[model samples]
Target: MESNILVIYTGGTIGMIQDPATEALTPFNFDALYKHIPILQNFNCRIDSYCFDPLIDSSNMNPSFWIKLAKV
Candidate 1:
């Protein structure tokens, strides 16, 4: 059976990459993420994400956000 997998990244370090030019860590572009990690394309499932417009700090997470995710 095929399953839809939702990978939620709350702007944590796990979802960032080091920009060699600027020596800074930036959010991975979910749209182009597969290009960077080609192995993901081999998966048999559909992968999707819901990201913040501007990454938010984990400490600032609010209930409204959870509610929004639940609706998705």
Candidate 2:
């Protein structure tokens, strides 16, 4: 059976890379994450991602955000 994976990108240092010019560790674009980690292609699974707009600080997460995630 093929498993499915959902990568939820909120905001933090999980899969971030430093922008050499600005020296900022910004979040990697989830839509193009496969380009960075090609090994995902070999897996018997579906990989999808969801990004939070206006990116939350995680610490500021409220009940509505939790509800959105639960619905996913």
Candidate 3:
């Protein structure tokens, strides 16, 4: 049976990419994530992703984020 799963990116190396012009780490385009990781297509389930509107830095991780995550 196929299952649906939500993948939330909480901010980390996995969610960052080096900007070509400035060569600095920045929030990646979450919309294009599927294209970058085509392996997800092999799964027999549906996968969706959610990224923070104003991506939070890992240093600022706190209870608020956890509370929101729990609600989802």
Candidate 4:
């Protein structure tokens, strides 16, 4: 049986990449996930992702984030 995994991106270092030009942090494109994480290509399960419209930084996380995540 194929398992399933849900990757919820709440936005933090895990989902950020530094822009070499400006040296600024930016949201990593989840669309090209395989390019970043080749290991996922070997997975034998379905992987789904949910990214917040406006990613909440780790420092800004609170109870509301958990509430919202639970709702999803």
Best by TM-score: 2
- How do all models score by TM-score? 0.78, 0.81, 0.75, 0.77
Ranking of models by lDDT: 4, 2, 3, 1
Which RMSD values do the candidates have, in order? 1.7, 1.6, 1.8, 1.8
Q: How many residue pairs clash in each candidate?
A: 0, 0, 0, 0
Question: On residues 1-72, what C-alpha lDDT tens digit does candidate 4 reach at each position?
Answer: 889988889888878888999999998888778787889889898777889988888889899888998998
Summing lDDT over every window of 10 consecutive residues in candidate 2, give the lowest-scoring window.
51-60
lDDT of 1 by residue, 1-72 (tens): 777888777777888988989989989888776888889878887888878766777787899877866776
Higher-scoring candidate on lDDT, 1 or 2: 2
Location of the lowest summed lDDT over 10 successive residues in candidate 1: 49-58
- What's model 3's TM-score? 0.75
- Predicted model with the maximum lDDT: 4
What candidate 1 gets wrong by more than 4 Å, as runs, is none
Model 2, 1-72: lDDT tens digits are 999899888777786888889998988888887798899898899999988776778688899989987986
Preferred candidate (TM-score higher): 1 or 4 = 1
Task: Evaluate model 4: give its lDDT.
Answer: 0.86
Instruction: After superposing candidate 3 on the true structure, give the runs of residues whose Cα lies further than 4 Å from its correct spot.
Output: none
Those runs of model 4 whose alpha carbons end farther than 4 Å from true positions after fitting are: 20-23
